[model samples]
Target: MTALTLENFLPYRLSIASNAVSDAVASAYRALFGLKIPEWRLVTILAEGGAMSQQALCGRTRMDKVTVSRAAIALSERGLISRASNPGDQRSHLLTLSKAGWELYEEVAPKALELERQVFAGFSDAERQLLREMLDRIETAVERLEAKG
Candidate 1:
């Protein structure tokens, strides 16, 4: 059997890289917009996808219910997002960005894109695309394993 080594493990490497990138981005988001990664994610999703219940946000974001609920509460408290009774399901509330939220998104999206470009500056477009494809495949593989488990 092969000796286990953390440095040689793909999952370890993947996690380290992911944490480093997320930390950098999180720092920037906090500094520039006072938004945590999850909060920004919810804002962006609501901006793009329109009103959605917390359950739907969880599905769309792959964030757990607690994280989504906390972000939704924070955004709502800030007046960045407003909650309304879901017409489809009165038991659940749908969250939608307020005008302030739209305004914030417009300002943040460009900075986010610029940050992305800076992160991948040395990589060509094709390389970036390939990386994305590989990440998608990895997610799919993990999901398959999870389903089996």
Candidate 2:
């Protein structure tokens, strides 16, 4: 029989590590670009995937609908992103990177990459690859459980 200790739980440890990393990078993003983590995520995703509806953004970002909506609204208000009528979905609007959004992405992407490099500087290439694969496996496991429920 194993004693249950929250500190020793793999899920707890993963959550703690995730929060710590997010917090550290979030501070840099806020300081450098005045963008919150959610806003930065939307910008990065849109830059890579082009215009998408809020529902699609939620799936692509693994963010809740409300969070994605709020980020979209914020970005739109700032003129970084634009919202347009979605021809395919009347209930949803498509979000696209405006000229300003593209400009901001261009500026932020390099800094974001540099921050990523710094965070993984202690990790070897193999370690990083393994960590990423482990995360993907964890996500898959979670999705499997979610699908069951």
Candidate 3:
């Protein structure tokens, strides 16, 4: 029988590495902007895509509705984001970054790139591209498996 060791398991190792990087990024975001990971995710998504509903954000960010809602609420409270009634849907509001939020995003973007550089300093451009491809492939495989189930 083949013995299963979690330490040697690919999924387990990936999860651990992902969490480690997430924690590091979370710490920097919290310290610099008082933003949690979910909030930062929402901000980045909104920055790139403009107005969107929380449901849309959830789908785009792969975050649950509850997490997206909480982040939206926090950002609204900070005056970093605003929610306007959706023209097409009365039940859902579209969220957008306020001017202040845009300014914050400008500040955060460079810091984020710097953090990524610090974390992946050893990787060459090709290696980084390959890693991204591998991760994308893994995500595609997992999605296919999920669909099958």
CA error at residue 94 for candidate 1, angstroms:
0.7
Model 1 per-residue lDDT tens digits across residues 1-98: 99999999999999999889889889999999999999999999998999999999998899999999999999988999999989899899999999
Who is ahead in lDDT, 2 or 3? 3
True-structure RMSD, every candidate:
1.1, 1.0, 0.9
- List where candidate 1 sits over 4 angstroms from the true fold: none
List the candidates' TM-scores in order: 0.95, 0.96, 0.96
Locate the minimum summed-lDDT window of 10 residues in model 1.
17-26
lDDT of 3 by residue, 5-30 (tens): 99999999999999999999999999
Q: List the candidate 3 regions with Cα displacement exceeding 4 Å.
A: none
Q: State each model's CA lDDT, in order.
A: 0.94, 0.94, 0.96
lDDT of 2 by residue, 2-64 (tens): 899999999999999889989998999999988999999999999999989999999999999
